[model samples]
Target: MDARSRLSRAIGTPVLFCRHANRLYHRRLGLRRCNAGGVDPFDADWDNLLVLDACRYDMFERRADLPGRLERRESRASTTVEFLRANVDGRDLADTVYVTANPQLHQHRESIEARFAAVVDVWRDDGWSDEHGTVLPETVTERALRAAEEHPNKRLVVHYMQPHYPFVGADADFDGGDFTDAEADEENVWVQLLQGRLDADRSDIWECYDANLDRALPHVEEAMRELGGKTVVTADHGNMVGERAFPIPFREWGHPRGVYTPELVDVPWLVYEDGPRRAISESTPGERDAAADDVVAERLRDLGYAE
Candidate 1:
């Protein structure tokens, strides 16, 4: 094993080390990354890839009114960082430019810059919404459109952090902004629901989640119209809301990495073809500016992730 894997296993032996434990559990179950027979999205044919963060196939199947041939695919991981490590990190993607509102990419920013043609950090570009505590879908849409115009020869990957958390839709009640200022337990709704601290019912949470997805679809459609190409709208992974975990039979809340439940790993693969495909050619890897560690941590917190 490599040094990282060895250290991960050592740290994962303790249940208290949640992150390492999550990784170890997936590894032990033969479900980590490329091991679970999941599709490697980069291998798929597309000129543009639109990723909806924490979006489930079932929810998307029922709700999304966009034009496309929709299908289902098992994702390589159950979380964004895991997906990045599996499908994006350390890869030669100099023909592509990624425009993203998801700050989790900051963890892999260095490697990403060395691999892709360019990366537009929407979060750092005033895309973050102070009122929403997360970047709204519209911000990602506008940036992606600009990226498409700027890098006409490259493939595009637009990742939108929506239907994920902070529930910024009209019906959402727990729309707390500046999550860094909130109490630790209260900042993450999923954590609160898991610990029985959240007062809202599970069904209500599901409704709000659906509402958030509803709020993003129009923006997604708008981007698709503006950036015409052979585009695929998919997700990094799906969310789990009180679904029963495998073997242990415990109910799962949120998308905790390593739990390869269908609710967390199954995602939608919708293809929308318009205009001609871009003539993609890889030049050399490009330079990129990354947000600071403290800034990324704060953004992650605002996006409902603990530092």
Candidate 2:
């Protein structure tokens, strides 16, 4: 009936002294319920947008800064807020869809697979070693592109286990070198932080990461070109490498719990059209010259050109 009685009933606390005290505090602060019911500000049209799970914002930022990386049409703030709001409200954009490879969504796999039947194609890589340990090689983007082409009318949802871990295979080479155990450990920590394990030594870890980027980008580029859509690229989270001088210091590898710092939270996003304009740019004399030397160098280096 009274504020004191209501407070007691709401909190289920029998202490009059504490209840009275809290009432006084709320009165002094002039707190009031603005709305009796929860109302959503966003429309139910979010299901139309293509959602890529496990995308990190920072990684997307860094990738966008690269020389030949694709460009983005949306502002970071808009993207972040929209994504967060949609996720929180469980609203699906009418024209959009979501595709992810996170193990947590295993239960929903069948539904997702069936719902996006035309666009979604699950590729299991049998021998690829990613940050998550041993994974199937077919999960890579190259394979995803071929799958996307198979369904020309549908938008694609590609999930690649990249730069994630185990850094396996000759194709997984970083900075033209295979990673040593110590080096791999060090790099792993760096990636952990970049994906957001810890918060500090990002600069140090970034060097090794940049090299890995050099390795992974080509595959990503090829995939984007093949998809030929308004491709949005990002990571689900980032890693922390030697940030705070704290190595994983444990037998277990990959992103540990609560390591979801901003590093892991950030990701890269790019959009490119696979039409005449992109073709013209690729064929341009200047574009050809710039990409030519770099392509040859990367190929030769990967192929033991010098060795």
Candidate 3:
């Protein structure tokens, strides 16, 4: 084929081919000035690590305003400052990496297995035991504590898998409600719908899912308290509880692909610390006490002990 025809076939359009060719020619001729004075991407401190699962950034933003406390980051440009704030106040923020609950992340058994395995490996390497079926959040927190104990000065990362589906096990000290065959069936149905199996209303399922989050918070709090260091809580992804056009068409459960709609993508970020709290307006002792109180309140609320 002639050069013009070959170029057209390669790019699928003569216009695109010409556009790209012109761009390349300009670059070779130094017509495009390269700017290298931008902000350094690697300037942030990486010594601390915080990982949250099933967390939505938008949700965090909303709750962060509940008490009208100063936000972690006032300007969008101060992400590094936000990270420091999380550690100083022991609060989780939306700055942590958030993995969207895309179809590839948890749609199939293999994918779920792989994702869990990766999380498990991170815990195991940090001295977590695999003999027990500890929840992902607890496992990660325990590992962080162990690391903090050994290194003392190093940053720690804790991962929590909350507000996800399949509410299979008891949460921390909570009575996980009744796990009868009916509940199991319900869980299966929710899972199927999440996985794209059967059509069903997700409102009820989402209620149960939020309950699971309430159930899991105590364990997370316990782990954080034990760490006795800067604690940041956030999520890797969030869930889409029946928003948008995507209904639970199947028995599949959990987050699905193309579902990163606002509902499933927003998460909560909280930070708590036990000592030397110099970042926020709160004092160290006061923040610690408040953190403890918050955990208790969350537990009581989940158990219907509080309004």
Candidate 4:
């Protein structure tokens, strides 16, 4: 172990050390795996790619009642940043238009602006839900419908921040706090569950997860119907709930970067076809609206990412 890790282990809480070790362990694992067997969404056949954030295959299989051919595929990464780094960074994709609700993509704004034909940052718009601490799937659906009409000739990639955290469904009360507040154990639902710091049970947590998916499915279905093309609904990555970290005897909580475990990497690939595939075309890259660094950080924190 490195000196920083040793010192952290010496002075920090056991959970803190485990967090560091787990990241180091899995980052090494990812280097060996190198995302060798994962599916690249760009190479897949689809006119519209709907990315549901932090959604798992098994949960999608059990809860998603959308019409499509659903199959499981290992993702290229275990976290949103890793996903964007592996699949989107340093690529020229001027034929596509991205509509996103997650603010994590801001890190790649320059690349995204230089590559994609257009980027609709719904998160920057008035789509954010301060009450729920996430951009509701319905808001994304509305923006996606408008984007589809506006860019009829371009491939659309709409990313929804749902079925993830700050669960805003009927079971939203299970874990309630300011997602944008300063970092604390209670602010992160997954960590709370992981450390036994919450009063809720595992099954209850699953209900909240399922309810979040339920909240997003209708909006996803709306997008599928209105977009009118080959739409593939998949996730950027899957969430880890009580899954044991491999080669380590600890139960992992949220999706950690570089972790290649099934709970964190395996995601749903639900392909649904409509009228016809879009005649996507390459065009001049468009400008993307910039958010202040503090705003981006606050929104990311709302999504359970701590600096």
**Cα-based lDDT for every prediction:** 0.79, 0.36, 0.36, 0.79
Model 2 misplaced stretches (Cα beyond 4 Å): 1-102, 107-115, 118-132, 135-139, 169-208, 242-261, 276-307
Model 2 lDDT tens row, 169-283: 3233234234422233333433333334434333433544454444566666666655554554544334444333122222122332222233433445454444532111111
Note the residue pairs that clash in candidate 1.
none
Prediction 4 TM-score vs. true: 0.89
Rank order (by lDDT, best first): 4, 1, 3, 2
For model 4, how does the per-residue alpha-carbon lDDT over 1-307 read when each residue is reduced to its tens digit?
4556655653566764676666667667335433556888998888999999999999999998899899999998888877887788778988998899988778556554337888888877488887777799999999999998888899999999988886777533344443223233324667666666655556777777788899999999999999988999999999877878875668778886666788888899999998967888889987766788888777777777752
* lDDT head-to-head 2 vs 4, winner: 4
TM-score, model 2 to reference: 0.44
| RMSD of candidate 1 to true structure, Å | 4.1
Residue 8 lDDT in model 2?
61
Candidate number with the higher TM-score (1 or 4): 4
- Name the runs in model 1 displaced over 4 angstroms: 1-25, 29-35, 110-114, 174-187
**TM-score, one value per model:** 0.87, 0.44, 0.44, 0.89
**Highest TM-score against the true fold, candidate:** 4
Q: How many residue pairs clash in each candidate?
A: 0, 55, 44, 0
